[model samples]
Target: MTEPAQEPPFLQDPYAPYAAMRSACPVQSKPVDSGGRPGCLVIGYAEAREALADARLSKDTAAFFDGRGSRRRLHPAVSRSMLASDPPRHTRLRKLVTRAFTTGAVAELRPFIARVTDELLERWSPGERFDFVAGLAVPLPVIVICELLGVPESDRADVRRWSAALFSAGEPDVVDSASYSMAGYMTDLITDKRLHPGDSLLDRLIAARSGDERLSEDELVSLAVLLLVAGHETTTHFLGNAVLALLQHPDALGRLRENPDEIPAALDELLRFDPPVSTATFRFSTEALTLGGVEIPAGVPVQVALGAANRDPERFPAPDLLDLDRDATSHVAFGHGIHRCVGAPLARAEGEIALRAVLHRFPGIRLAVPPERLEWRRTRLVRGLASLPVLA
Candidate 1:
C-alpha cells in the first residue's frame, strides 16, 4: 500500500499547512540531508519550546562533519560562525558579546534609537511614498549597528551589504563568494579598529575582560560579524513584518492606533503572526532521542519551526488570527535557552518605537500596492516583505 504523497511542500505562504502538520504529526520524521538518515520535525508548541532549551541538542557543527554524516557544510558561509558552535566555545563567545548587550546595558541606547527613528521619519516628508523595508527597516539597523559597534556611520553601507550577504541563503557558490568578500572586508575593518580604537562596541569587545578572559582574535572577528548580522537581520523583518501585518488587518491596526499603549502586545502578536526568523537557529541531535513521539537519532539535525510553533493551537488560541490585544508570550521569535538573543530588549525597543512612529507619524499611512502583489523574502530563514511600498 502506498502512503499518500504529502501535499506539495508548502511555499512562501505556509502558516496554514504547518498547523495541519502539527495536528497530524507533532513530531514528524523527514529525510535528513540528501540521502542520509531520517530526522524529525518538532511542530508542537511545548515540544519545540522544550527542544530549544534541551541540553542534548547541540548547535556545534563538529558532529555534523564527524563520522555521524558527511562533512559538507550545510549552511554555506555561516558554518564557522557562532550560530554553528556549541558548549564551552559557545559559552565563551556568548559571554564577551553578552556583557555589551546585557538587559540594562541595552536600555542606555534608547535615546539614540529614538533619535535615529526621528531622523529616518523626517526623510519621508509629509505625503511621500517609499519602500518601508528598504528605506527604514534596513537602514535603522545599520545605523544602530554602527553606533553599537563604534563603527563610523560613513562605512555602514558597505558593512550592511557584507552582513546581508554573509547571512543570506543562496546557492553554495554564491554564498561562498559573499562569505569571502565579507571576511576580507571584516579583516580590513578589524585592522583599522586596532590602529584607531574608538568609543564603540568594537572597542568595548576588544577591551572586554572577565578577570583576564578576553575574546580571542577569531572570537572578536566572528562576534563582530555576528553582531552586524544578528543585530539587524531579524529586527529588519520584525519592523517590516509588523507593519505589513498591521496594514493587512485594519481593525488590528486601528485597535493599536487607538490604544497606542498596546504597541508592545501588538509587536508580540506580529512576531507570532509572521515571525522574522521562520525557523529557530539550527540544532543538531546528540543521540537517539524522542521528541513529541518521533525517535530522532543521534547526529541528525532538527529545527524548531518558530512560524509553525508560534501558531500551534494548543499554545495559542485561534493561532492564525492576529489579535492586537493578545498577551503574546511563549513566542520563540527570539530563540530560547542560553542562546536567547541577548539583543532582544534592544530589538523590541527599536521595533516598538520605529513601528509606532510610522503609525503615529502618518495616521493616513496605507499600503501603496495590494498585499497580494507585494514581494516577500524568498528564503525561509527571514520571513519579511521585500519592499513594503507605503504612502505616509
Candidate 2:
C-alpha cells in the first residue's frame, strides 16, 4: 500500500483520480495506483457491483493468510464478524442481527432521532462559528448507537475513541490496540446483558434464536462490536459529507430549503455525489477472474471504489452533478449484495432527520472557511472531512 504525502490532491478530492481511472480503464491492476492496493482497483459501477456479489471474491482475510507466514494477528471479534466472514458463517451472524435492524425496528426510532437532533441543534449559539463535526455529526450517531446497544452513557466516549482509531489511517499498532480494547469491552458488555437483559438490541442478540441454535459467546460479542462500530462510523461521516456537499452546492442546498420534502431524495444524491466510504472493504479473489476486462488472480486483494462507481458516467448522467431529482436509488454507497449494510434503514432515517433539522434550524448556514482550506480524512477505506467548520 502506498501512502501519499500530507494533503495530497487525491485525499482532499478523490473524484479527479476516480474519473481518470474510469475514463482510462474500468479496472487497473498494479500496486502503485490511486487506491494503492496490490491487486486491482475496480472503478466502474457494473464492475464494482459484480465484484461485490461474486462468490469468487472472498471476504475472509484469515483464509487469505492461512498458508502464508505473515506475522500479523487480527482481533477475534474482527476476524469472526460477519463483515470479515463468508457465507454460512456470515449467513448465521447476519440472520441473528438483521431483524433488529429491519425497517420497522428503525422506524420506531424516528421520534428518538428527532429528539437527539433537536438537543444537538439547541446547543449552537446564534451567529457563532462552530465545528459541525464535533458539535453534532460525530456525537449524534454514536449516542444513538450506544443507547440502542444498552451501553452506558459514560462509556460512549471510549467507544467513539476506539471506533475512530479503527478507521483512522496509520499505525497498525493503533488499530490493534483499539480492536483489542473494544473486544474486551464488548465481552464484558455481553456478559452483563446476559444477566440483566433489556429492550436494547444487544440484549435481544444475547437471546436471539435461529430455530434450535443460538449465537455462541464469541459470536455474540463480535456481532455487538460490529454493530457498534459499523452503526455509528459511517453515519457520522455521511452526515458531515452530506452537509458539506450542500454547502458547496448552493443550488442543491436552496432546493432543499425551499422544498423541505426533498431531504430524503436529496440525501441519496448527496451520498452518490460524495459517498462516506471511498471504497468497500478489501475483497480477496478466491480464484482467477476477469473484471472490467482486467484479469485478477486468486488470493489477490481487490479494492472496489464505491465513490468512483457512484459517479460512473455510464450509470449516472452528468455524474458529477448533485441532482436530487435524478434516480440515485441504485447508488452503492452502502455497498451491495448479500453483505450489503444491514443498518441502512437506520442510517437513512438518521440522515433524513439530521439533514432536515440542521437546515431548518440554520437556514443561512455556510462554510466557516474557504472550500480550499478544508481537510479530508487521510484514510483510503473511508472518505470524510477531518472537521467541518460552519456558521449558523
TM-score of every prediction relative to native: 0.91, 0.95
Give me the runs in candidate 2 sitting further than 4 Å from their true place: 1-6, 32-37, 209-213
Q: Give the Å shift of residue 359 in candidate 2.
A: 0.8
Of candidate 1, the 10-residue stretch with the lowest lDDT total is: 1-10
Residue 230 lDDT, candidate 2, scale 0-100: 94
Compose the digit string of candidate 1's lDDT tens values, residues 252-364.
88877877888876777888888888877667788777788777778777878888888888888998888866678778889888888878888898998897788888887
Candidate 1's C-alpha runs over 4 A off are 1-12, 31-37, 66-77, 209-212
lDDT of each: 0.77, 0.86
Residue pairs with clashing backbones, model 2: none
The digit string of per-residue lDDT tens for model 2 on 166-264 reads: 886766677878889999999998888778889898888877666634888888888889999999999989999999989998998988988889888
